[model samples]
Target: MTVFISPLIPVVIAVAALVIAVIKDYRIGTLIVVILAFTNVGGQQIFEAYHVFLLIIMLTAFSLTLAVLRGSVAVQGIKEFNILLAIFGTWSFLSGVIAIDHELWFGMIEYMIRAFLVLYLVYNSFSKGEEIFRLFKIIVFSMFLSSIISFFAMIGSLSLSVETLLSLFSTRFAGTIVDPNFYAMTIAGIIPLAFVLITEEKRIALKAFWIISVFFLMLTIVFSQSRTGIIAISIIFIYSLYNLMRKKRVEILFFIIPIIVILILIPPAFWFRMSVFVESLSSGARADTSVVHRLLLLRSALDVFLKNPIFGVGLGNFEAIAGRYTIDPMVCHNTYLEIASNLGLLGTVPFVLLLYRGFMLPKHSMQNPNVRELSWAVRTGLLGMYVAILFLSVPFKLDLWILLSIAAILGRKISSEKSP
Candidate 1:
């Protein structure tokens, strides 16, 4: 019962308190708003998995429209996202309108709706910056608790009543989300937040606590052995260490570690992931057992592109189209190939712009120490996600979609305050 409720209860009470506070006092609403956004992330994503977030998105549109019409451009970050979503949505409809493949059209609309909701949270959440920070603190606090429970559960250190409920492999150790890879990636993503917070943390004990959390998070990351999780963590660590040791020599050390990782650690795993891949490239079609399967899927997608050329096959039609070329019904694990094959250059280009811009904007984000400091956690995690994508065909996941939307909204929020 303790493990069952450990993850859920505090946030629930925080939400109730937040709503009550918002009704009773406007100042409290600030924190409430942030609390709401922070708590909502995994929940909404999980809800969406069950197809509920779609209904919620429609309701949100109505609610948000009321807010917008009242001249409450109060959430400029959300506003920019709406703008981008509009572009994305408009193009989505264009795909439906022009798409020869019908399934792709339906998929595009579904993708757009979810994108909008994610944008909404990001946009509005920033309006409560201090609250976001507070909620972040709360989240880190909660994560710490989760870690503590998980740690003892590991070594037979405690024979707690909830011990049976805790299984590190499937359930117990998840930071917030239950999936180990997602947990690692998300934790890695937020390291910048901790890094930023540590700079402001005055209490010696609190500072030590946050530092310890980093160690715990890294341990789990390595434990997960999800290639992307490790890669993402490494990327964030480099960024964090660079910030910590500002001297040129320290920066070089950051770069040097990766060389050692590649030389020492990555070879075995990389070779394992690439064994069939290297063989396939060398001898042509003989080796089909490895990550080369994904590469094969890419070639099939390219063939579909060549055939359709203009609009290509259609969203989700890669299965259908690829089957026409190969007996096996395979999906393109490569996003670029999938996008071009399905929607062709037209449907895929603008969305690519959205990603390109989001990825590019972080460099500019580094300009201000405050924004950098504040956003670095998310940014660091993003850097990891970026590096991870080279190995996994994961960018198309709504996980990334949600992440990218939040980031864009935050960047817009920060930029808006700077402009005026």
Candidate 2:
């Protein structure tokens, strides 16, 4: 009865699970990678430094090795989009070589490479409709887990009350991502996937799970106090509402009930934060320092773009030279502006084309009846993400790349089904 187990036993079990994941299905390994990448667990200090990166490398290598053994490792799906990404990557590398800040450039390049690898792995590893659906479920589950973490974090940090909420206007619930805006946007982007799952799942228990997950996810956004996240989620909700009304009219309760609960739970402080945008528009006075700062950053980015219209000041050099144009000396808060100011037309053109290709994938896939719902989900999710990034300068965000790859994989599955 007093027999004890070694601590290494847990490690051994984990290794065994990982080996099974790699050998049984590369999709499982890829899903593990996605969960790690999205949760930002590997970046945390509790683990050894860069442990997440090592896990990613090992999982990716194992998955690719399995693909080779099964004769399934081939460059496939979204050829045109891949080409555009390649061109963009090449241009960024060339631009980075002459960057005003080599340190920043190196860091950016490293992130870019990792994001690209995730996209490549996901697109090639998944081909079947079931596989794609499973991927979507796993992604939504990961976000749901993140939302739970944020809920507890908020609870532990401060007592919940209207007065306390008002006093903590600056407090943002970031969950594990560490950045409130990005965390909020990430949750908003996954909401569509959750909605799709809700519509597809016939089991009451599972449907309820998704509904509760959505409620908590929305609550996290309100706590984040991110204006951009609010806008993005509003767009997604409107889209999902339209889709639900057209088809799943009865299931509308599943969507509406959670939203009502969130509306009730949302604090006055959130509305006050959101009101700044309205106040600025109505009065043409930038009372909010954050809004004013972002506008100044926007103007400076435009100025940089105009000054270096072809190749830009150089990749990741915008912040280094930002002080020359504006007092902020910060990277532009807008993703489009960040790219336009950093890479200019040479990089911007291919990058825009790549996004267009991603959109087109889901647009085209909607024609196939079997995959229509899934395609709609991907399109809506991508739309939310694209909108969210307008105010966030994150060109190398892992989630964006993963979503684009999902679109490509869905499109490829549709085409293969249509083939004779």
Query: What TM-score does candidate 2 get on C-alpha atoms?
Result: 0.89
Identify the runs in model 2 with alpha carbons over 4 angstroms from their true place.
Answer: 1-9, 16-25, 43-51, 69-72, 157-170, 243-249, 281-286, 415-420
- For candidate 2, the clash count comes to 0
Per-candidate TM equals 0.67, 0.89
What C-alpha lDDT do the candidate models reach, one value each? 0.55, 0.78
lDDT of 1 at 205: 92
Candidate 1 lowest-lDDT run of ten: 30-39
Cand. 1 Cα-lDDT: 0.55
The lDDT of model 2 is 0.78
Worst 10 residues of 2 by lDDT: 411-420
- For residue 247, model 2's alpha carbon misses the true position, in angstroms, by 5.7
What tens digits encode model 2's per-residue C-alpha lDDT throughout 1-420? Answer: 699989999999998887776766676777777887676665433457346565665676677876777886665646767678877899889997669998888877877787788887888778766677777788888878876876666666776788675555557877778788888778877887887788787789998888777777877787788888889988887887898798857867776886788788777877876687777646746467777777778889999899889998777889999888677688798888898899999888988787778877887778776677788888888889889988998887878888899888877656535311
